[model samples]
Target chain A: MQIAKVRGTVVSTHKTRSLTGTKLLLLQFMDAQGQPLPKYEVAGDLVGAGVNEWVLVSRGSAARIDDGMEHRPLDALVVGIIDTVTVENNRLYSKKDAERG
Target chain B: MQIAKVRGTVVSTHKTRSLTGTKLLLLQFMDAQGQPLPKYEVAGDLVGAGVNEWVLVSRGSAARIDDGMEHRPLDALVVGIIDTVTVENNRLYSKKDAERG
Candidate 1:
């Protein structure tokens, strides 16, 4: 799993029929210090994550687990919402901090 | 599918038993112009692709199709090797070029 920040939403009505009800969000992968990487991808929203929220993204085949996406040709998926992230016992990011300002 | 170039190989002898016989190769994603993206991943090799070969990577659940990975937790499988890539009549990459130099 990689840490990512939800950047935007994707509203696609002309996609394949199997992808009809899936929620797609634009994501920016973040480093441990909460900085965005240059790579960005569109991922399925499985946890109701809103824009600007920090999330854990599961890539590749792991992203297609049991979501009616078995045949939908989806790749990246938002799997969890991160409340806090710490590295080497050092505070890096916290949802409370994002909520405050 | 995305274009990726195999950079190296991974020799993991202590991994899960399900992955015992699977070949894992390190890959770097490539941009349309044949430059490498800043991303690298280890993917299962099904087509016997050697190092430095430009391959077409099918990501997400699509990566786990067949090859007896249904019961195993594996992601990022190499599905195909690219013969050539042409965009707007421009030859972006070719196996012949990679074989030349």
Candidate 2:
């Protein structure tokens, strides 16, 4: 799993049946210090994470374990909305920070 | 999912019970052309992939869908071994090529 920030949304009119009603969000990978990396990925939102929320992006087949998500042809998934992140005892991210930023 | 080359192995005697007997292989991310990227990851192997083999790394909870793996706390998993990859009708990799290189 990796920390990431929701950057935007993806709108696809044509997709596989399994993808129907699945919210797709654009993500910028972030470091432990809550800094964005120069990397991006489109991920399926399973946790109702909104844009700009700090989320945990589960990569690999682990992203599809939710009920009804199997065989969905999804590679990345937003599994958790982080409430707080502390690295080396330094608070790096919290819901309040996301709300204000 | 991404294509990667198996680079090494990870031996962990102290891991979660679900990870017992799970082969952890180090992977170097690869471009579609079969060139290695600078990025690397440690992925669980499920398809009996071996070192130097080009395998598909499934990210997210989708990695744990295999029978008996649903609750495994794994992030990345090897799903397929590449026999041949032809992009734009240009053969970039093949089992035969991997054997020769």
Query: Global lDDT of each model?
Result: 0.72, 0.73
- lDDT for B78 (candidate 2): 73
lDDT assessment of candidate 1? 0.72
DockQ of candidate 1?
0.09
Candidate 1 per-residue lDDT, tens place, A1-99, comes to 899887665443333344558776667789877887876666778789987899998877676676476765467788899999998998799899999
TM-score of chain A of each: 0.93, 0.91
Q: Per-residue CA lDDT of candidate 1, range B7-48, in tens? A: 999898988887878888999998655689998888887678
Give candidate 2 misplaced runs (Cα > 4 Å). Answer: A1-69, A72-101
What are the per-model DockQ values?
0.09, 0.09
Worst 10 residues of 2 chain A by lDDT: A10-19
Q: How well is candidate 2 docked (DockQ)?
A: 0.09
Would you estimate the TM-scores of all the predictions? 0.53, 0.54
What docking grade applies to model 1?
incorrect
- Model 2, residue B85: distance off in Å is 1.3
